[model samples]
Target: MHSINDAAGKILSSRQTVALTGAGISTSSGIPDFRGNNGLWKTYNPSIYAHINTFRSDPALVWELAFMLHDLAASTAPNEAHVALAGMERSGLLQGIITQNIDSLHQRAGSRNVINYHGTVDSAECTFCRIGEPVRRAALPVCSICGRTMKPGFTLFGEPVPPSAYLEARNLASYSDVFMVIGTSAVVQPAADLPFIARENGAFIIEMNSEETGLTNYITGCFIKGPVEQTLPLLVNKLNRRN
Candidate 1:
């Protein structure tokens, strides 16, 4: 891991800097980081909603996921890291943020250039109709039109990422000069591959995770081992001081 001062300065100096965030960034906000040994995936039986087969079998799983998501978003507020990243966007130091988190804290933090890779829980979509409709669940999910069923606007485990969101994230990673990966475990596929893709695209990789990850060995630029709340604010402050 590189020194914070050194990493922050250089990454801030980058012209077209961007970030790819994961659940670790929101763990502090109370949404448990999934995929860890005791994460949501491991502790709970996830077929309820995170899989296409389960959803097809019982559309109620979609409603279950939706309610859980609604409660999470309703409870967890954006933390310091989210605010700092939003500030970075406002300052023009960061071009955009691509997040794997389904929670919409980044939007609440006032981030403008954000591409949510996993869809959002803020809105629900009809699984049967697929009409790109907006249906909010005040209590439970019952589609007004088809009255079939509705689910969160996110990708299930067996489903592919949304093409529009995927393209936007890929484009940002491909063109970015500095790739800031914050608080991600970097174990998941496709989402984890973005940093490697960014490196292949001739960009500097700066990882800010609480501990070592699979990407650690490949980070030729910098690696800051600490929580995002501690690291991002300092980085933002470092950039703020430069002006």
Candidate 2:
């Protein structure tokens, strides 16, 4: 509670506040994260199912995972954490969100300035034509332009993060005065470096997670320890009260 108040105070005072979200933010929406105890990666083996090599060699096989992700995103709605962030953005308390999720929950929740670092599950991109189409469950989707198989919109293991998205996220991190890391363990590379970037740029860090992460130990000024779904709304409420 004290931490939430402090975080809200910082956000209210800051010129720019940015949130870097992860899979844990969507877990309450019935989506499982990739690295948790019962994470999807444990069962699916990302090396075999999510790598670009596997996707290139056996696109049909890759579709199995892609379709599953699409159905899950289709089935679930954004949880309170996502809603709170969207509300903050709308109210001008937040600058934007940089997310590691492909769930599209942030956008669905009404957040306009979202940088989806990992891409999205809303559509699939064609390898040859470089065009994208909505994902379909009826069959393995093929590209309309070149008849090549379409790849899921989410970034695969071997693929680079979209350069444009990364640039936007990097700029946001570098400029933000307050940075919130929510529901991530801060382990994965590239995406994981965002908080550090914000820290290097002198941003005050606030972290909300079920447990302490590397950022919690090193950079976090306020560790609002709890489920993000619960903590984030509380922070929003505090900000509202202060206003």
Candidate 3:
């Protein structure tokens, strides 16, 4: 088992990397992680809010929940980890970022090659036609072009993953030389499966998590066991030094 600093060195040495991020990456930005005490898991059941079924059935709460989260997200900014990822992308080592988080922090940090597996919390769409448009936090966010209910451009639990986003994440993972899994426990489906696919296609797997994410065994590559904000900056600095 390598210490945090040693793992950072090896990560910066790798090329053709694809990052897999989870809630932990954004927790520093005031977003709540699901597993921790103050996380969503401790606060609410996932089955209640992860899908449209809950929204359609009880919309009052859906919008209420949205309002709260959106209000919170509005004030949050990108953390050091996010900036470091953007810096890595600028150096052209990062091929893409596969994130389970709905927060747009990675994109905001200037990373253009992000694959938002869970979709973003910003944009909205017409539920019926699936045509998307930007939405603001007005008293009512209705569609001007179409007369349909406007919902956030995210995958509700029962909904299928958006094809374009899903395929892009898989393709990047498939061709990556290194799959960097960060802040995720590796228990989630689909996104969890992505690293395995990459590994099968000859990608090295690196995991970073504070807890035992159940993936430490399969990933023979480096594991930086610390907070992302503390760890990613160090890795990015190492990458800067190598040149």
Q: What is the TM-score of candidate 1?
A: 0.92
Please state the error at residue 94 of candidate 1 in Å. Answer: 0.7
Per residue, candidate 3 scores C-alpha lDDT tens digits across 1-243 of: 556555555556666789999988899899988667887656556578656787777654555556666677778999999999999888877878988888889988899988889777787777777777665777545667777567777677777778888899889888888788888886677777888888899887777777656778766476677898998887777777774
**CA shift of 191, model 2, Å:** 0.7
* Full-model lDDT for every candidate: 0.82, 0.90, 0.78
TM-score of each: 0.92, 0.96, 0.91
Per-residue C-alpha lDDT of model 1 across residues 88-182, encoded as one tens digit per residue: 88888889999999898999999988898988877777767875555465655667789866766888878888888988888899998899888
Cα lDDT tens digits, model 2, 153-222, are: 9899989998889899999999999998999987888988889999999999999999988777688898
Model 2 lDDT, full chain set: 0.90
lDDT for model 1? 0.82
List candidate 1 segments past 4 Å from native: 133-135, 138-140
lDDT of 2 at 96: 92
Q: Is candidate 2 or candidate 3 better by TM-score?
A: 2
- What local lDDT score does residue 95 receive in model 2, on the 0 to 100 scale? 90
Question: Candidate 2: deviation at residue 241, Å?
Answer: 1.0
TM-score of 3: 0.91
